[model samples]
Target: MTGPHALKPFLLAFPGPLRDRLVAAVLSGEKTATTGLLLEYEAEKEELPEVGERSALIDSDGREVAVVEITEVQVLPLRDADLRLALAEGEGYRSVAEWRAGHENFWHGEEMREALGDPGFVVDGDTMLVVEWFRVVEVLREA
Candidate 1:
């Protein structure tokens, strides 16, 4: 899956079931956006994707599923994420509170806590997040 001629690769956003469900959502045109760590993950890796960048969406197994173009990129605090952003997330969250609750759980999960080496990791208004809006440019059908 890694070669000059191979399709470009981008993370599937989440892991396991969440990733699968979200990918399916994107394919079905229900999801148009995603969010991720701006500092700890992107900046740390020096791989912050820019607006207008196109990427091959990959599954948990590292298989390319689709290609998407980033339409918008917003660096904002977790507290600044409003219902508009949640709606763009395409998760059917009715309100920002609901979205925040769900994301707080994800960010505080055992895996993330261990990865960040901060068991007390918490999502606050100041927590920076890279919210990316995307559109599916092409769906790579399995061969």
Candidate 2:
């Protein structure tokens, strides 16, 4: 809370079934890491998250459900994502390839594409990615 931005919103994804599922995972401590596109940060004109920084995990209803502290932050090509990160996501992926495929499907979905403001946007291995690891600091909602 000492940073320029005291607290920011940590949104997982577009609201709906997927967001609900991801929120549930975080609330239950099943998820500790998440992947994001570098373009997203650029698009929003937001600074990249840093280790030790905290943000409010917002739910679909715009509620600050929890406070999560960033423990790690890595920026790399999507192709460089490894098994450790794949497992850290807590999405039950058995391999890195599976993880990439699953995420590709998500990134290619209508909602994500729409949010990116490029209906034809497509992610490739060379795409820049921001992978972050966070820990739940406090639960604001009972879940």
Candidate 3:
């Protein structure tokens, strides 16, 4: 078993304003969880992060800000996400409706489509996602 101190550093990229906000929330301890589209992982040919995996939280400028350790990993449909899980994502989302609206907008936005090169992409009830719960293990004040 690997501990945070023994794990190799993986990269968690926060590319834009919303991701930046979520990164800040994680650093501040307000956010302890996040979700990623399973399709994105599949498209990128990336393996799902397992529990106990530690990663460097990277900002838009490609700097490491903190190290986080995954505590849990859950695979579920997007529509199965509940309010409790949404609240754990932080950003002051008071209700599931708010969380779904924000995430749906992000997932279906032009920016994502352009980046992924799939203009017809859609997130429906059956959309699969990797739900991860993590904790900030160390904040890199200088990197």
How much lDDT does candidate 1 score? 0.79
lDDT-best of 1 and 2: 2
Could you tell me how far off, in angstroms, the CA of residue 47 lies in candidate 2 after the best superposition?
0.6
| Model 2 steric clash total | 0
lDDT of 3 by residue, 1-143 (tens): 14645444444333777667777788888888888789888888889999998887776666678889999999999889999888998878898889888788888988777766899999988999898899988898633
On lDDT, the leading prediction is: 2
What's the C-alpha lDDT at position 99 in model 2? 92
- Could you tell me the TM-score of candidate 3? 0.87
Task: Using TM-score, give the best candidate's number.
Answer: 2
Q: Enumerate residue pairs that collide in model 3.
A: none
- lDDT agreement with native, every candidate: 0.79, 0.91, 0.80
User: CA shift at 127, candidate 3, in angstroms?
Assistant: 0.4
Least accurate stretch of 10 residues (summed lDDT) in model 2? Answer: 1-10
- Descending-lDDT candidate ranking: 2, 3, 1
Error of 1 at 73 (Å): 0.4
**Residue 3 local lDDT, model 2:** 70
